[model samples]
Target: MSDTSGALVLFSGGQDSTVCLAWALSRFEHVETVGFDYGQKHAVELRARDEVRRNITARFPQWADRLGEDHMLEMRGFGAVAQSALTADRAIEMTEKGLPSTFVPGRNLVFFVYAAALADRRGLKTMIGGMCETDFSGYPDCRRDTLDAVQTALNLGMEQDFIIETPLMRLTKAETWGLAKSLGGEDLVDLVVRDSHTCYQGDREHFHDWGYGCETCPACELRAKGWNEWVAEGRPTLAA
Candidate 1:
């Protein structure tokens, strides 16, 4: 049997997290997943998370046994405290603080803390996240430096060595698509396009080749741009 020492992915049911989930499943012997519900405006992604999980288990024979139990944490109060465009009904723009309205203060930090707590309990040593610097809003938590710092803190505080893996930390959105293809092939790519959710507005009514979304929000824009770039490049291999 594969051990829980493999990895735990911080899956948010978005394109990036879904790809990260697949990445973990491909590389790890036993991969578990964790998702958070901070009252996100686009709560539909939570549903998508379940769909994606079921599809991965059913479609990927090689990964069927490697996948393990899933975990969900409810922190709706966090959304109430850290109000942002993502957790609250506010316009997606820049605050005078120079951060995007989607910036849920300390959201990612809390995620690592919570995920690490769970990982410790689950006997997992590695945690994977889709946090990226490229093709992202200026969310400080998603940056590489922030994640590195958090990892150090988690180790120091917990007195246990835990590795936080950000597979898409440096990869652009377009490269992420290529990564999904590389890890799981065209079928995975198709699954991502059809099942993954990324619209910040939570609009699933509007469907685009990239997926269901408002098609104009920041999240949709990024996903569409990546798809367009991939298509233009003949959809060849994209390096990390």
Candidate 2:
């Protein structure tokens, strides 16, 4: 938070991004969120993003003040080329590379580039995103090395000093749940469970202790497993 102007969060209204948003509010003087509409089949994510933001604002006014402007840019062009279940009408499948069908090529890269542009224009030197290598699908872009390369490329391209923050880069899904608790306690974690959208299927109707999801998609399975393990491990609190 120190030596920074402000922070912009690349929010997806999902479990990880929600935690990142709360994390930013706790540490930064000013924070903003930006989401993408990349023609994903789960369109509810767009509405969920705004809903989660509103809930956070109403519940934590002080933190909400630090949470500044938000953007939900339309990015259907990503679906045009990527053959992923996220943007295509197909069942999730595994690949030889160990990545699932949900893996959207260049999605994270595109997001970072757009986020960098927004941050540069707003004089925000820090950009936060919720990409974790742990407890994540086999998406290569979620790796630390990939993010580092993207950050380097973005800074060199923009000719601006930008700090790309990944608060949950190494954290598990359960650890992320613990992070929410550490940031704002049980209420915050509960809010995340109730408000965040992590389902690849956009199934918000069904709810669970971990979160609302289809419970069958890769994201839901991972989240459920991590949360169950964390709870079994006495629900240990993590440092913010």
Candidate 3:
């Protein structure tokens, strides 16, 4: 059974997941984080994960005590099995199957499954994910329906009720930036922009207002577009 007071956040050290982390910290008394290292092309995110956690704990004193242990799950097996642009050093493009080349089949499903397993061990009933549908690469696994189904299957198979919370599910990237501001103000937004890594091509040499990424990649383009839109909208803050 899931507890209402604590949560496990699926933190990827990217802008979106970092916002989700702050979101979890704002509401939950106790929050833990879990990240997967599936041999992603952008493994720099792995490094950013620790930095993001440290930054959050340091910058948000209110959440310092609430932030609990961080877990990094190694899934080299997943890397081998779920071959895609992310798991391989391939060109980032649209696949013949109509999905982004970076779309690793079942990646989110596997992530949630493993995250649930870790949560079970840690006695965490709630899971916080940053999966977005409004401004995403059309990954089937990022959809709410898919996550809901996975949640049901997880509960049935594990004989435990786990709540999957996707704060960014219905939000656009611009709205996500607004959310970061809402959750932790300018500090959080700056931290996300400075520390997060979201480029599929794993480019950290160039920097953008949104974050560090390759300007041409789909991920970077989406982030830049969102940042610009949010800026043009007077950078309005939203209620979390």
In model 2, state the lDDT of residue 83: 62
Q: TM-scores, in order shown?
A: 0.96, 0.97, 0.97
Each prediction's Cα lDDT score? 0.90, 0.88, 0.90
Tell me how far the alpha carbon of residue 151 in candidate 2 is from the true structure, in angstroms, after superposition: 1.0
lDDT of 2 by residue, 13-68 (tens): 88889989998888888888999988998888778888889999899888877878
Poorly placed runs, candidate 2 (over 4 Å):
none
RMSD of each: 2.0, 1.1, 1.3
The sequence of per-residue lDDT tens digits that candidate 3 reaches over residues 151-184 is 9999999999899999899899999999999989
Could you give candidate 1's per-residue lDDT for residues 3-63 as a string of tens digits? 4348999998999999999988888888999999999989999999999999988878899
- Per-residue error for 205 in candidate 2, Å, reads 1.5
- For candidate 2, what is the lDDT? 0.88
Clashing pairs in 1: none
